[model samples]
Target: MTVPFYMCCQYVDGKFCFVLHEWCAKLPLKVQHHVVHPAHTFFLLPKIPSKFFGVFNCNICKLPSNGFAYGCTMCGIYVDINCAFIPKEITHDAHPNHLLSKVKPLVKLTKRNCKACNYPMRFRWGYDCTSCDFYIHLDCALFLPRVTKHKCDEHTLSLRYEPAENHISEYFCEVCEDEFSPWKWFYHCTRCAQSMHTTCVPLILQCEKSRMTYDSGGVYNFLNVKFGGTLEIKGHSHHLTFVQGLESDGRCIKRRYVLELSMIFKCLEFALMDQIDHFDHHHPPSLVHLQQPSNKSEEDDDEDEEKDEDADNFVEEEHHGGKCNMCNEQIWSFHLSYYHCESCL
Candidate 1:
C-alpha cells in the first residue's frame, strides 16, 4: 500500500505519477554553486537527461532519483533535490582543501579503498581530485551530518573530520565501542566526551515523506527510470523515444538502500553503459534503437537485419528473458542495473 499526498510532481507527461512531494517539486530550476558540482550549473529536470542508462542516480548521494532531479544536462551529471545542498568544494581538517569532483572509474579494481576512510571503494561512485591522488567515497564525502543527536549523549554531537587536537593515540566509538579510523570523520559530544563512528549514526529523518508513492492498488517505489512514452522531435516525423529497454524492463523498479554493495555495482554498471552515448557526436550507432517504437513486426525486423550486417552489434544483448551470461543468474534487467554483453549472444 502507498501513502497519499495532496499534491505531487510527475514528469514530462502532464498526468501525475505521484513521485515528488509538493515542497520538493518546488525546488529551484537551477543553482550555480552547489557542492555536488561547483563548476557547473544544475538544471532542475522532470527526469534524467539521457536514456543510455536504464537508471539515473545522483552523483552526490549515489541514489536513484526517479522523479524531479537537478542535473547538468550537458555533462550528464545529476543529483536528487534532496541532496542538492551539499557543496562540491569542502575544507575538511582530515583532508584539508577538500575540493572533490564527481568521477567514474575507468576499470574495476579488486580491492580499492577510499583515501579518507580506508574503506573499500571498489565499484563505488566517488569523488577524486585531479591535482592530487585524493579519492573519497561519495557516501563518505556526504551524509555525515555536521551535527546529530543520539541516545548516548545529552548534547548534540558534532562531526569532526580530523583527529581531535587533544586526542590519545587511538580512539573508539562510544556508541558501538568499536575502533574506527581517526583520519575519517566522526561525531563527538564535547560536554559528554563521547565519540561515534559515522556509520554508527542512526538515520534521523527530517520528514515523514519518503521518495515513494501509491497509485492504484499496488505500491510504486520509484527507483531508476526507464523511458516509456514517445515525444515528437522537431524535423522528425517518427518516434525517437525507445521501447526495447522499456519492454525488457517490464515496469518493475526495485527498491534499494544506499548502504548496500549491490547499489555500487548497479552504479558501476550504468556508468559503463553511459559511456556508449555520452555525447551527441560520440554517440554509438546503437542509439538508433530509440529512433522507432519497439513494436516492430516480423517484416520490419527482417528488413532491418537486411540493411546492416552489424545490426546486432547495436543491442549488446545476452539473451532476452533468459539468464545473464556473465553473472549466470536470472535478471530482471530493469530492477536495479545490469550489464549484458554480446559474448553470450
Candidate 2:
C-alpha cells in the first residue's frame, strides 16, 4: 500500500537525509506526568541509558526501543517516543459524564481492569475514573478517533460514548450487526441514526485502487526511523537503511498494526516471550501479524477479535516439514514470522 504522502517528509533533499517524521518533530523536548513514572520528568534521549541490560524496554508502549526515547532514569522509566504523546487525561465517548484519567503500571501489586470490553489491565495501561470505577484498555483508547466518514452512512458519523436513549431494539453496528453495549463507544450519523464500532472506521480504501493485498509475505517489525539509522537484516547480503514509512520502501502498516493490536486480545504473546531466552537465540523473536482481507478495508487491515483463533489455526495447519525441538512447530521460515528457536527457525 502507498505511504501517506505526508510521511514522505517535508523540507528534505534526499531519501536517507536523517529527517524526522512530521509527528516526531513536534514532540516536546521534555514531558512530565504522562509516562511510566508519571511523577518524574522524561527527557528526550538520543541514546538509551547504559544501565539498561542488553535491550531497553519502553514501559509505556510495552515495546523494546533501539532508537530515540523519552526517559526518566530516576524511576527507571523509558518510553517509546511515539507513545509518550498520549495524554494523561482524555475525554472518551464511552463515559461522557467524566473525563477519564490515564492509568499506568505501578511497581507494587495493583489490580484494575476495563469495566467494558472485559479485558484486564495487563500492561496497566488504560483510561479510568476512580470514583465512578470505570476503566478501558489503551487499545480501546486508541480507537477513539473524534470523527470519520464511511460509505455505510450518507453523512459523517460523529463518535458517541453511548447510544441514544430513544433508540429502538436495533441499536447495533451497521457493518457487523452485533448488538453494541450501551456504554461502549461508537460512531453515529445524526441524520441516519446508523451506528458503527469505533474499531471499524477505515473508509479510505486506497489499497483497492492500487491493487495491493497485505499478506504475511513482507518484512515486518516496528520500523524505528525516528533518529535515521541503518540496520543489517539477518542473513541479508547488505546493510538496510531505515526510512520512516516510504511508498516504495516496501514496508506495510497492515503488518505493523495487526501485530500491535494482538496485544489487545492476547497480552500473553510478548509478556511471556520477552523474558525467556533460548539457547540458540540471544534476542527475543519478534512477533509479526498481517491483516486478513475483510469484506471492505483496514487500519490493522482485517483480523481483530478473530486474530487469536486465526493464528492458532495457521500453526496447526503447518505440517510440511520436521518440527522444532523447542516448540514442536514445523521448521518453515520464508515469509512468515513465528516465535521459535533461531537455529531451528
Candidate 3:
C-alpha cells in the first residue's frame, strides 16, 4: 500500500515514528531556524509502526511518544508536537521586562524546580532567564489560553499566568473545591469571584449549566414551601430557620437572633437577584431562625459563661484604661458603653 505524503514516517535510530506533516510545513521561518537539538535538525515523522518498536520517549518532555513527533535521526533526540513547537523566546505578562528563552538545563542541575508551578522540572524543555532565577515548565508556559468559557459559571474566566501581589491568601478552585497553588496558572472570573484549576476546567465544562427562573411569585412560593424548614449550614454551630417577609431596619441589628435572620434575608435577596434555582423540588424559600436550646441547664451554663466574660472585661477595663480590644484605642467616657470598636464591629 502506498502511504500518503502526510502519513510518511521518518526513520530514526532504526525505527519509524509518526509526525504531523501539515504542522511542520506551517511553522514560521524564525522557529524553523532555531533548531532545538544541536547535533542534528529534527524532521516530522508521519506514523510509528505498531509492532517491534522499542520504548521511545521524547527527550524534551521525557514522555513516551507514539504518534506525531519531531525527531533527529543522527542524535536520536525526539520530542512530542507540543514540546517541539515551544517558541524560542516568549514574553509573558508575569515577566514583561525580559523575554524568557527556551533552553535546556545543565546536566548537573537536571532536577531544578520550576518557578511558575513550583513543581520539579523533570521535563528537558523549559523557558528561563540566564540573568535571573526565573524558570517555567514548558506545559505551564504554553498549555493555557488567555480567556476561556465553562458551563460551571456564567462569566468568562481569564487565565492568570502569574500570582498577583495583593492576593496573598490561599485560593480554592470553585469547581474542584481544592486549594490552588499560587505558583501555578489558574482561571479567574472577576464578576463571580470564581477561580478554578486548568485540569478542572474540562470537568466543569462537562457539567450541565444550571438555569434559573426569576418569577417573584414563583420564588416566593418556592421559598415558602420548599425551604421553610431549619437548615444546618457548615461551620455554624447553630441551626438556622429561614424566615419570610421580615422588614429590614436599614441598619445592622445588635440582637443575635435578629442579626442571623437579617443575614439570611440578605442572602435570599441576593439569590433572588441572581435568579438562583434550588435543587430541592419539594421545598419553598423561607427565612432562617436559630433554634433556641430547650434545656434549662444549658441556658444556666450560658448565663454563667456570660457573667464570667463580663467579669473578665471589667478587670481588663480597670487595668487597661477601658481600651478597645479590637483596635487597642482608649475608650472615652461617652463611648465607654460600647466595648467594641465601631469600625471593627
Query: Which candidate do you rate higher for TM-score, 1 or 3?
Result: 3
Q: lDDT by residue for model 1 over 211-275, one digit each (tens)?
A: 21111001112333343545554564455443222111222233323321121211112222332
List per-candidate RMSD values in Å: 18.5, 15.4, 22.5
Alpha-carbon error at 282 in model 2, in Å?
36
| CA-lDDT, candidates in order | 0.53, 0.53, 0.52
Worst-scoring 10-residue span by lDDT in model 2: 210-219
Q: Candidate 1's error at 217, in angstroms? A: 36
Most accurate candidate by TM-score? 3
- Whole-model lDDT, model 1: 0.53
Candidates sorted on TM-score, descending: 3, 2, 1
Q: In candidate 2, which residue pairs clash? A: 93-161
Error of 3 at 261 (Å): 47
Q: Candidate 2 deviates by what RMSD? A: 15.4
